[model samples]
Target chain A: MAIFSLWVINKAGGLVYQRNFADGLAQLTSNEHLVLAGTLHGIHAITSRLSPIGASSGAQVIEGESFKMTIFLTATGTKFVLFTSLHETTTDSVLQRVYEAYADAVMKNPFHTPEMPIRSEGFDSRITALIGTGQS
Target chain B: MTIYSLYIFDRHCTCVYYQDWHRTKRPKPAVEGGILPAVSHAITPQPLPADSNAGSTFTSPRNTLTSTSGVVIAVNEPISPGPGLYQTPPSHQQTQANPPPSTSGLAFDEEAKLVYGVILSLRNMIKRISGRDEQFTNYRTSTYKLHLYETLSGYKFVMLSDPNTDSLRFVLRQIYNGPFLDFVVRNPLVIMDSKERGIDNEYFRANTDRLVKGLSVFP
Candidate 1:
């Protein structure tokens, strides 16, 4: 199984960070990438509003030809988007570990700015290490 | 989950049209002023030598005709050898003569040029390496996807959409065959030879917007 990429979106639908582990994907302009995050956030909000009573409003999986997207939302309104190959089945645990790492390495960092695009080296290294072990 | 914009470039690497729908931080148009010339210069196909044309069929209009995935493509015929669309600007040389300015303000246009350059380079590289003149359809990233449909005449239709958006090659072809060919290409008033300009007709814009909105999955 292959993991393609990852994205982090804030509550305002802005993309805070993005990383690609695989190649051959179409590259987007920085503005276009930001627009994509906003669009997804709007779609998620609309989906939540349309949800039936007693059901969760957040989107979970978006399946494609060769890959699948899994969205994990945090209590503080942060979103983690994981793009994994179709055969990858154990993603929940992976997402949970990533969330834990983000809380420890990003949120707790004194230099990290709130609601801005994440630029912390610690967060990157931690997430990279987590992804390495998860893939193995 | 949404479409941000659409850009159409001609065979000359001129961005003939650009439209934004859902983008927030719109970059200044002047920022893109250097991209067209840079890209045109980068991807100008090498001219064939005089001896290689032996026995080649001399077709009227000089355009090469081919079909891919049910879409008809017409390769653009070389118009002239002089300074028409193929000429690269001297500004590129001026930068060599004098020191270039800092790149902080040119980030957006730089990325745009890079994207176009990469696409053109990859297309030519793949054709040469694989020995197949296959047409590019679409490519996806983790968050978004880009769809491309090119006419034989070298007019390219490109759309940026959500990664999970179903294949829209047929839709792009339809737009090309239906509204684009009818309203823009064939219209006498619409000048196709202009540089750094888009098709500026209300009829084309209205109809195209309608066509795009009519799609079942567009949101």
Candidate 2:
């Protein structure tokens, strides 16, 4: 399965980063990325707040079937979202790999600002390597 | 005169320079406490000479120092033993001891500032798109975040992600801090309010970092 894109939303549901890897998905305007981030954040907050203590921690929060989105938290309390096509149940693993890549490339780089677009050379290279590895 | 000294004992390099503009000598303003000893001691920022424009191909401000002193101390800094809490205080102290020179105004020209501003804004944009938090190593954090994205079309759009409200603020502070702060803000070459649009990602990618270094200013 090919992963298509990624989006990150702050705890407050603001859109932080959005990128698409493939060309099939319909393009969205820059404003739309912001709106989409806010919308997803809103949805995530509602889901978390509504869930009972037991249900919130373990279950995969699903927004729709068209695309699958998974969120993971880091040791330092940051949320990462990985958006993939509608074919997977084991997205947590892929998302984890992306997180590792982010930690190494984006977070570690002095120039990288948290919750922003991916611009580090290391990031692009690592992502390309990971995606390429997955393809083969 | 430019004076260079090499400390054989400490293996440090020291340089100092001073120039007299011979303009009206205004009295230095007294500042409270130890906030800004250097600025408090300096003369007023005079307008550039009538013959020299800001962006002209001349010596940069760093090159034209009125009075400057620099000593590169070659201290044998100890490597940290581990990722422990014990090392945090000293690391912070080190940062305080040697503040990073501003990397923004290297070119020191009108267009250079504009270019540098664009680079700073782009870097900020990349940071935003990467979903990283912004830390102003200078002081406390600013309350708002400016989000920008450049599409493949070579256009750039910025959004204000205010923490206190829902309304979006579409101002580019980096650009404001850049050369076009006065020109771009007042001139009609740009649009401030747009819902969201496609932009030239390549154009930004090509020029941003170059601009960042060009507009950097050193103390």
Candidate 3:
């Protein structure tokens, strides 16, 4: 599975972390990333009302022609968004693995503050090791 | 499987015609009350399973009739053990708390606008990211799946169905080419893209309703 990029949004709709793996997507400015994250946050809230059922899971997967976005929302409102190639169907497992790495390496670190931009070295290495092995 | 609703938007992004089959919670303008707060202070809506059917209101299938003052309790929530008549006064306290609207249902116009906004922004985002000309056909949440069909003339027909069902964009297309064309585009009396008026008329609504209800997925 080819994961194009990843974004981690805090509960308040701020882009805490973002990284690109494969390079098929058109690049965006850093400011644009924040705009996109905030837009997604608002859109997620809106999409819930679109559900036919009274209770709903907001935008879970949004598919384009080239890539698809799978969003995983934690109970406390943190969002893990992954951009993957259209053929990659195992996004759920990848998101779970990433969440595991984040919980252990990032959350446990003393230097990392909650809801702030994550700059943990342990988490960085863990993600690279966990995901880097899949690529050439 | 159940088909919940269909919304048709014209080229100018106005909701031309709307119909619903089995949506329990509809858009309503809440005037005065603490309904919104009561809902938040108590139970939050968790996603129903993919197979959830029409009239299967929020929360558990066992206690479906247990709606209290516009709020629904979660499945694991303990019912009062004191007595059968003993009901908690959660509603009394919330209604006194700085009254937001008692019902948090969206207004009909606002709901239509929100639906259009979602598709418009999503379409734009898809174009910029993929840099491709292809339009998005379908997307799914845990509770429901939305199938979108766009005509060359820019009419968008969106249908919300059970998440377990397959893509039904073809159904939307059929509605567009059949009833929409016959009652709206072909009729000379109906004005095209009128700002204040909708394309919804007796003939269009009747035909569309028949077509939707006749589908194999309709319960």
Ranked by DockQ, top first:
3, 1, 2
- Model 3's alpha-carbon lDDT is 0.70
Model 3 per-residue lDDT tens digits across residues B73-180:
353454332222124354433332223322244545456677788888888777776666868766778888888888998888989888888779889988988998
Error of 3 at A96 (Å): 1.0
Q: What is the DockQ of each candidate?
A: 0.02, 0.02, 0.34
lDDT for A83 in candidate 3 is 89
Candidate 3's TM-score reads 0.76
A15-127 per-residue lDDT for model 3 (tens digits)? 99998888888788878888888777767766765665577778898877678889999887789999888778778888899999999998888888998999988888887
Docking class of 2: incorrect
TM-score per candidate, in order? 0.43, 0.35, 0.76
Model 2: how far residue A110 lies from native, Å: 1.5
Classify candidate 1 by CAPRI docking class. incorrect
The interface root mean square deviation of candidate 2 comes to 23.0
- Residue ranges of candidate 1 with Cα displaced over 4 Å: A1-136, B31-112
Give per-residue CA lDDT, model 2, range A70-123, as digits (tens). 667565435676655556665777678778887888778888776566667787
lDDT of 1 by residue, B1-219 (tens): 666556667787766555555554333222213344322222222344322321121111111111211112233323232222123234432232222221112223333443454346435432332234555455444445567777888887777666678778787788888888888889987777666445656677777778887777677
| Tens-digit per-residue lDDT, A1-136, candidate 1 | 8676788898767789988776434555667667656655544442332111222234466444445667888887788888786668877788898899889988999998888999988888988897855664
lDDT for residue B57 in candidate 3, whole number 0-100 = 17
